[model samples]
Target: MQIDPSATSHPALPFEYDVCVDRLPDIVTRETESAVRSGAIPTFVSTDGKTWVSYVDLFINMGQGRRLRDPASAFFVSPEAMRRISYSSDQIDAAGPDLSERNKVTLAGAKRIAATLAQLRKDLPPWPYDLRVPWSEDFDFPLAAFIKAGQLDAYPSGRCWWVRSVEATKLLPIGESFDDPASPWFVGPHGRADHAEVVRLSAAHRRHWPEIYGPALTPRVR
Candidate 1:
């Protein structure tokens, strides 16, 4: 979205539209217009511990959207399966002359992700979790499997990981110019009733599932 007209208030951050949309649950977006501000939510740390990246950026980059392949390729190996296979830099060098430099780098990065995921999985159970399921901080979500190796990183669920991104975190829908029903971001003042509506709508739109969009668009009568 064209630098949100509320730029003076929402001041932009370094993230892109899709990243912001994907990680909507992690951000606080329903505050008053004057209170809504832009910032980063540090979610993941680099394996080396020297740098960090937000969930949105990392999620999009690591086989989720735009930056990588679709989340359905054989690449997104399960965390359990990923943890099973050991990864090492030597594995790249030993790949021989046939392996291109780009592929070698990807392999090395995969090793890092595998290591990180292995460490994360230590605190959780060995079961496939759905990314589409409602997220809760109280529960340990399977982040490692969200997007792996350019795939939605699924088990038997067959759900997708890379959901659609939105143009804005919050839309006032206050004026005729700003209130366009055709726009997916359109949220009347009454929209405040359900803060998560934006995310639900975006995901449904991204998946092209009219069934979901239809129900979500039905106005709440509270």
Candidate 2:
């Protein structure tokens, strides 16, 4: 959907904090494209709207909390928006499998949501596989399942997903799941696969302070 031009200027109850939420799906879509094109890690914002960081900054040897917090980092919103957008953009356009019938299942009440969860439980791939990095193959099904099952909320700008369980904020963890050589979850600067720079910096620190920065600070070459 087209973003409201005034969304950039105004701040409302939920969408007030960031341009990402104010613009909703549109800004997220554009930002996803930008992040991909620029070879930067996808963005992740916490449900409470209090924290955000790029995957590279969060996981790699890079110092924590160093990257900018914004939607330009995340791909789809939570699973709900992800499904709807997939239905309209991929399904309707015949570019991907059509979940038309599945999409019609309303998440209005708890019962319906539960039923949807049941269907998703059967359809989704098993864990570990489901927890793979977003850019990996077969990632969407498990992610959609998690959202429907009230395990994850990926909405841009940090608003909680509509279908998540109350305890999800505490139970479910978001972001990269595993380390893969093909698509390493944590990369060096600018999301590059090589961690040489991170290693070099750590080595330099070790050389300077042999006792202080010891083995704990050693960079893992993934």
Q: Write the per-residue lDDT of candidate 2 for residues 12-86, one digit (tens) a residue.
A: 212111223322355444544455456553333435452222222222323211232333543323422321111
User: RMSDs, each prediction?
Assistant: 20.5, 23.2
Q: What is the C-alpha lDDT profile of model 1 across 1-222, one tens digit per residue?
A: 112324222122221212222222222222211122233233322233322232322332232211112235322222221111212223334236777655454444333433333333332222232112222446422332333433333332233221211212222244422235565333332221122322343343223322222355432321
Instruction: Give the Å shift of residue 206 in candidate 2.
Output: 49
Deviation in angstroms for 93 in model 1? Answer: 8.9
TM-score per candidate: 0.21, 0.19
Backbone clashes (count) for model 1: 5
The parts of candidate 2 lying over 4 Å away from their true place are 1-22, 25-72, 76-108, 131-222
C-alpha lDDT score of every prediction, in listed order: 0.28, 0.30
Query: Which 10 successive residues of model 1 have the least lDDT summed?
Result: 80-89
Off by over 4 Å in 1: 1-94, 125-222
Which residue pairs clash in candidate 1? 71-151, 71-152, 72-151, 75-149, 76-148
